[model samples]
Target: MTNPYTTAPMPPQPPLRPAPKWARKRYVLPALALAFFIGIGAGGASGDDAKTTAAKPKSASPRPTVTVTTTAEAREPEPAPTVTATKTVKVTATPAPDTGTVADDDSGADVYYANCSEAHAAGAAPVHRGEPGYASHLDRDNDGVGCDS
Candidate 1:
């Protein structure tokens, strides 16, 4: 007899058994796939005769056509008006007086600036080599222009 105050030892568990070969995923999946393919093939074969008997060509009706007509009236072009008049008046030409500015000089050498500061003060900073007030001393980089800064 077991003592009421003492607990009994648990029995050893049974060893695990492997799944059956037919019940494994590898075998069962392929078997189910084969059965599914067979079922589809049987169903398609039995429906072939019904499909062939029920298939009938539909009758075609002629599509409607549309016609459009347009007309334009022809008219002769109108002749332009002709008028002639003659008048004579005497005219006099006057020469403009020269203001004698640097714009009148072809060389533009008359326009002068002593330094870049003077050129900037005159609001003519970036003077090109050909333009007025451009000097080599003002252009430290000697890139043809003067007072670039």
Candidate 2:
């Protein structure tokens, strides 16, 4: 609600002074960037000088070559052996007298083996009733099943 034409009082201000040219921050960043690039260029130049002097040329005529020689052999293989059937010759002669001294393995009581495995392997197991090798000792129960153990 004060008068509109009256101006307000201005605030107090401080005095200014320039910083030192060498200590200012605006030029420090560009100077550091220039020094980094110079160092990298100097390092790369020293490495390239060694590769140019190590190269050398070689001659093909100075190397040696070898040539081999072998004696030739005859290629005819050995003849294979032939197989022939032999013809048996029969000699005609007179007959001899009869003899009854031949031995028989299946004698009286020693007919079957001690176990069924031995009897079956010898073609003698499961002898039915009234068969050639059937007997009372083989069929214990007399039910017609012999050597069933």
Candidate 3:
């Protein structure tokens, strides 16, 4: 039988050569130009450029005293009411506040409909945060709930 799968011998590769000096020194000029430009960008005088005028010594000029005249309305804000001594008065329940009732286990929607629906149906909701009817449970974000359309 003839050997149809036989292959010829491959030729040997040539020896590696050393790179030329110029090839080895590839980016010298570009790097030097970059450094030169960087030095120029640092504001140091180079080449022919020099001060056009005299190099005067720095002298401290008194900052012009700014006499800011404020209008009468711009005076200090009125001081808030100050209490001399904080008497630690105990929190005593006087009477149940007359605010409309919210039944336990009732959802906020139910509470709103039961309490605020009538008031708000007429116009914009009058109940606001910190008002008697304003429940944080109803408006968790405290951005005013149940009537300020």
Candidate 4:
């Protein structure tokens, strides 16, 4: 006795799956768009870029004017200083008159006794003409009257 259907074997079959649509178009279009935008942006930034400038100084307007007033007082004149002068004088005093002159009959003694003796004896008269009693005594020089000399 012998078994049949053992002469050959069949190959194994692989599993099946779904495929993506436009997959290749997807990466190529995006990469090209990215490169185009980047080149345009870089070219615009590099060549003939716009520059900003500062404004110029303008002329200034004229300033307003102001006025001021002041008052002054007149000066007064200065007064002159006062000055005084002093002088020395020599004064001579005369004696009282007697009854006789220096050379009269009674002589100078009569004049002394009549007019001067009373005050002379009391030590009241000065000794000489220039002295206090000189005026009270007789005319010693025989000039004109008692004490006149």
Best by TM-score: 1
lDDT of 1: 0.73
Question: Model 2 scores what on Cα lDDT?
Answer: 0.62
Better of 1 and 3 by TM-score: 1
Across 38-126, the per-residue lDDT of candidate 4 in tens digits comes to 99887665333333222345579999989888888888888888787644333333444665556333323322333454434534443
User: Ten-residue segment with the worst summed lDDT in candidate 1?
Assistant: 87-96
What TM-score would every model get versus the actual structure?
Answer: 0.28, 0.22, 0.21, 0.19
Q: Which ten residues in a row have the lowest lDDT in candidate 3?
A: 86-95
> Model 1, residue 130: displacement in angstroms?
0.7
Compose the digit string of candidate 1's lDDT tens values, residues 1-149.
Answer: 87867787868999999997867988889999999999988877556777776796667989999999889889889988878763433322222355665455555445677777667666778888878677788888999889887
**Each candidate structure's count of clashing pairs:** 0, 0, 1, 4
How many Å off is the CA of 147 in candidate 4?
Answer: 99
Q: Residue 79 deviation, candidate 2, in Å? A: 60
Please identify model 4 stretches exceeding 4 Å from their true place. 1-21, 46-149
Which lDDT values do the candidates have, in the order given? 0.73, 0.62, 0.56, 0.51
Over 4 Å off in model 1, which ranges? Answer: 1-108
Compared with the true structure, what per-residue lDDT tens digits does model 2 show for residues 1-149? 97767797757787777887876767898889999999888767454565664454554676576989999998999889989965443322222233655435424223434444545665667867655455567777889967766
Shift in Å, residue 129, candidate 3:
99
Best by lDDT: 1
The order by descending TM-score is 1, 2, 3, 4
Residue 79, candidate 2: alpha-carbon lDDT: 86
